[model samples]
Target: MRVMEAALVMMSGEAVVVEAPSVAAGFEALYEAEYAAMVRLARGLVDTTEQAEEIVQDAYTKVFDRWNSLKEPGGYLRTAVVNGSRSELRKREVRRRIGLDRPLDSGPDERDHMVDALAKLSPNRKTALVLRFYADLPEKEIAELMGVRPGTVKSTISRALAELRKEIDR
Candidate 1:
């Protein structure tokens, strides 16, 4: 199969190519497979679609640059995207503080309500919840990506769910 058509092996959380798995080919296949997902995860952090897109693009570029050295491209790429997104948000916050750009607060839409609720969560809870619910990752993989233990993932998810319920009921 062509690199673009390769089936991904993700059960154990690695993106494996069914074919030759050349560096370029494997990276290409994995990029096609996970780019949208990485963007979505980034979207949960950054304000605009453009910012999230740029972050994902940068993350993919870095992953491709280091593809030959990566032991687990899938996990590494995911962690990179999350890290990039957080960094973008921080930089954006600084820009807004110094008046480089206007604040992003418009009236809250329905989605904004969810975003508002998630914003109130500690970064730890928010990351775990987003990965578990939005990305549909297994706990083991989320733990690896978040650099936490499996038990921590479980408790984080549990606490986050409870907190979200409280926010929703408010």
Candidate 2:
């Protein structure tokens, strides 16, 4: 019953109105609006820009697949991005352990102090800190996205900040 109107231009310069179902239209709008932010979120969690882009694309695909039934598409998409980033990190760790991947040789002085400090934190702590500070999400929302209790998020962030302070002081 819900419809969205879009304008299409003909080769001859005539304009025509097209009606799309609200579901598809809504998804299109969401993709346009949140794609950049989602990429940034993934970038915060992942090591490379390419990986962040891939993770965000995968998240969008998952969101598109279940858009109609989703209760909160934005939140679901965010969770998907976070999960994808976590999976990628896990795969990289396995590769490193199996000798298929070499450790990055960049020295601490070559990177921004804050970024280096964050990279040294455990995945959970880094994720909590990124979601809370970089993404600027509230604690409750971060808890839902990270699939942990709010109290756990609070503690993780507290520990992460302490660790960051110590790392930066060096």
Cα-based TM-score, every candidate: 0.69, 0.79
lDDT of 2 at 67: 74
Give a tens-digit lDDT track for model 2, residues 25-127: 8888888899999999999987677889999999998997787789999989989999998888777778887999875544555667688788767778888
Name every residue pair that clashes in candidate 2.
none
Stretches of candidate 1 off by over 4 Å are 1-21, 89-103, 106-112
Give the lowest summed-lDDT range of ten residues in model 1: 3-12
Question: 1-170, model 1: which lDDT tens digit per residue?
Answer: 45434345323577665544587577888989998988888887666778889989998888876777899998888889888876765666677669997756645563567777776666678778888887788999888877889999999999998998899778
Q: C-alpha displacement of 154 in model 2, angstroms? A: 1.1
Kindly report the root-mean-square deviation of model 1 from the true structure over all alpha carbons.
8.7
Estimate candidate 2's RMSD in Å. 6.2
lDDT for position 79 in model 1: 89
Local distance difference test scores for all models: 0.78, 0.82
* RMSD, one per candidate, in order: 8.7, 6.2
Displacement of residue 123 (Cα, Å) in model 1 is 1.7
- lDDT, model 1, position 139: 98
